[model samples]
Target: MSIPFGHQQLHNRYCFEGKLELVTALRISSGRASDETDAPFIRAFDGAPYIPGSSLRGAIRSEVERVLASMGKEVGLISCTLFEKDACAEKARKFLQKIETEKVKKDAGSNKQKNELTAEFAKLELCDVCKLLGSTVYASRLVIEDALPVDVAIARNHIRIRDGVGIDRDTGSAKDGAKFDYEVIDPINSSITFLFKMTAENVTDDSDRKLINLILGLLKHGLHVGGKRTGGLGKIKLKETDNAFYKVSGFENSTSLWKAIVNGEKIHNSIEWQEVIKC
Candidate 1:
């Protein structure tokens, strides 16, 4: 594929064009109350329900982190939590101190300074998750756009309300005055189509390629995007309608490449990157 202007050195870019089909009711709550409902699905300004990009990105990142952890990779830096902040901070501080020590030793004409610097550089390097999703240190190479309904008018028919009640832990029964209702997308009699796009840039390293493949696999398999997972809400399957991998530095016309991607043609390989990676 061809690279656009101002991106002369662009290595590889992958575009994920897909639709999410709800297999079960989906509830991505807006956290707002209305006269007719206690909970409602998030909606656009025109009242058309949609999924936020940040929500999808967070879900994908979490799944990738879990997969990395299972493979025994060093995900400590990438999956650092609020409770681990102090420990991570101290660990980072020690890394800096070690580099400073190596610098001091080099000033004294030590021969092992180069090896120490190399080791420290490897240690301080960002993990694959941070490199793709972004960290406090650098920008992300992946971009996920908000998923909007392919047909807004048709989507309205899938919207419905579900009732529930909180259960008391002590009594193992329904709590008094705990009944609630929420809106969800009903997939029993209707199917809602969503358009999603994911753009990945600078995918030169083998590790990054592997990570992306893992994420795409997870997406294709299925995911619970919204709330009420315990109640079996938000069951979705993503189907890729179009995809393109651009590797060349430049081309005569950038518009044609985009047009080809949208038409799901002019690609050399299938959208399945998992076949290329070991995982």
Candidate 2:
């Protein structure tokens, strides 16, 4: 593994690839009403249902935070809630701001040197989650691609609409004229598999690397994605053999890298990290 210093570089790349099954009906809303339903599942340009990388990343980050919040103190680590603007993140934010402000005054011979300075500072300052997933200072090493249904026909066949309403807490009844129906992938019949792949660069720290593995383990047990968790939607899980990790190298030194032709590039390491790594 290579370290990320003074500036970030593509010294090493790791991709955690896997197949995930929908354990329950899923409703990832497109945020707008469709002609057929009040809330429709988001789709690609070709109309095939897809999970956006950002959405998946958000869910992964959220779960990781929850797990850490529950068990992190036991391990002598603290996972800060970035959403709550917690002190852990506040400290890192301030450090980044100070560095950014002072960068103009320093010699910072080149862009690489400036990045190196910032990256080094972040390595020592950022929390475990923010270090891997990004924060006010460091960019996230994790990159998740859109997860698509392995069998598009199956996904299409099992999608159905379910009725929903806004509850009037005061009266303990449904609000008048608030009735609506939203789309969902039928849980019983839609046991469709989705391909998920994410790549990261320079995750050399032992703790930081384990955080990535923790996410895979969490997904295997079960996790929710998209919207409607209260209604029991968006349940997904992984199989025993689904979590595959590949550490790819040689791209930086290879001339054919940019052409997407790294046939002979060194595959530094390969692993089924989920089986051996612990949170």
Candidate 2: global Cα-lDDT?
0.72
Q: How would you encode candidate 1's per-residue C-alpha lDDT over 179-220 as one tens digit per residue?
A: 788898887867787887787775644566677777777787
Query: How many Å off is the CA of 28 in candidate 1?
Result: 0.7
- C-alpha displacement of 38 in model 1, angstroms? 1.4
Top lDDT prediction, candidate number? 2
Tell me how candidate 1 scores on lDDT.
0.66
Q: What do the candidate models score in CA lDDT, each in turn?
A: 0.66, 0.72
Against the true structure, what is each candidate's TM-score? 0.67, 0.80
Question: Can you tell me which runs of candidate 2 are displaced by over 4 Å?
Answer: 5-7, 83-88, 103-113, 167-174, 241-275
**Could you tell me the lDDT of residue 252 within candidate 2?**
34
Highest TM-score: which candidate? 2
**Candidate 2 colliding pairs:** 6-115, 6-116, 7-116
